[model samples]
Target: MVNAQQYIESSFPKHIYRIFAIGKNLEGHLDLSEYPNLVEVRLGNNPLLTSLSLGPSPRPYLTAIGFRGSGITNFSFLANLPNIHMLVLVNHTQEHQAKIVRDINQVHQCKDQEIEKIKQQIIQLQQQIQSLKTCENSNRNQNSPPNLSSERNNDTS
Candidate 1:
């Protein structure tokens, strides 16, 4: 526990890529600083950690985060982690679980709208490509031997 605080205050060692703080023991320590280089952090089963104090600068690089059985009741800090790809924050009660689901759904809705716009753009491009192919085929038919030869014969007459 003391080493964790020391590492947070001082520059983290180059070898430490991930940190997993579990159990109900790592709470009430007010010196949680930012590990900007830390890739992953797993803090579960910590009943004492009523509120999570996330340090800045570590938000962008964090790829995975898990917080199951923690005492966190609000979903404010999670809204800031943009680089987090995979997260699991399941609680024991239904009300808390519903709040997490609602928050995820709200975020997902915005992403879904963006996805729909991209899909529409892709569809438009495909339609334009198909139209171009049709125009090329029609031009080829007009320049074929049958059409060109008939026109040449008529011109010679």
Candidate 2:
């Protein structure tokens, strides 16, 4: 039996390569284990979707994944997607809900803030270096003796 992945590539449309199921009343488990070539899977704003299975291993070609405002709690499945570049997860787990969203976005945002702080520090250091260089040149000029040619002319006069 040909798998879903094979069928998708061999089908009439030919290039159909994504799954988008958003803002629906979908509940329970949504499995996409067969389609290995899935490029993007956007399942956002579906508050009833509790469980999801995106296969055992990481999809090689999978690039984008969006799952926000859904009932899905555990995002351990996200580790199985290494190639995912774009991800949108917002309000998937509410404060009162029993659903627990692990440390994914929180860690990411913190890292971003840290990077910005480092960049600012780098800029400040560069400015200080420039200021030091200018001061060194000014001090050297002030401390230097008079030119040899001027002294010789004065002696001749």
Candidate 3:
């Protein structure tokens, strides 16, 4: 059961791109600050892991992260990985999954509402454009000169 401190002490290659620390019984915070080139991390089944320290360096290229059966409760660590596209949280209890789902649904609902509002604003802008076109045409017609031949015949009287 190697802990986080032991893992950090180990002189692992800095250029290693992938790490699979599944079931390692890692505890405390696992710091990956040394591995600047790390692209993927899989820490599944590490039941003792409570936190993760991604160091101060920005992992601009990191794309995937997964964790399962860990003691993690705070998800703020995800904010550090701006480019992450895939996140897997497996083996969570049913209640935990439900809570996560609920939070996701709330975010979805808020996005949906914003989308609807934008759609309505687009529709209103289209209507305003049509009204302007109508007004422009009416103004053009009102400003146009009358028939010159009709004025000539009236002058002959």
Which prediction has the highest TM-score against the true structure? 3
lDDT of 3: 0.77
Q: Which ten residues in a row have the lowest lDDT in candidate 3?
A: 73-82
Give lDDT tens digits, candidate 2, residues 61-151: 8888887877777666766665568877676445623322335555456657989999999999999999999999999999999799999
Tens-digit lDDT string for candidate 3 (37-105):
878988888878888877876677778988888877666555556577777788888787777556656
lDDT of each: 0.66, 0.68, 0.77
User: Which portions of model 3 show Cα errors greater than 4 Å?
Assistant: 8-11, 94-157
TM-score of 1: 0.53
Number of backbone clashes in candidate 2: 0
* TM-score, structure 3 vs. true: 0.57
RMSD of 3: 6.3
For model 2, the stretches where C-alpha displacement exceeds 4 angstroms are 1-16, 93-157
Q: Which ten residues in a row have the lowest lDDT in candidate 2?
A: 1-10
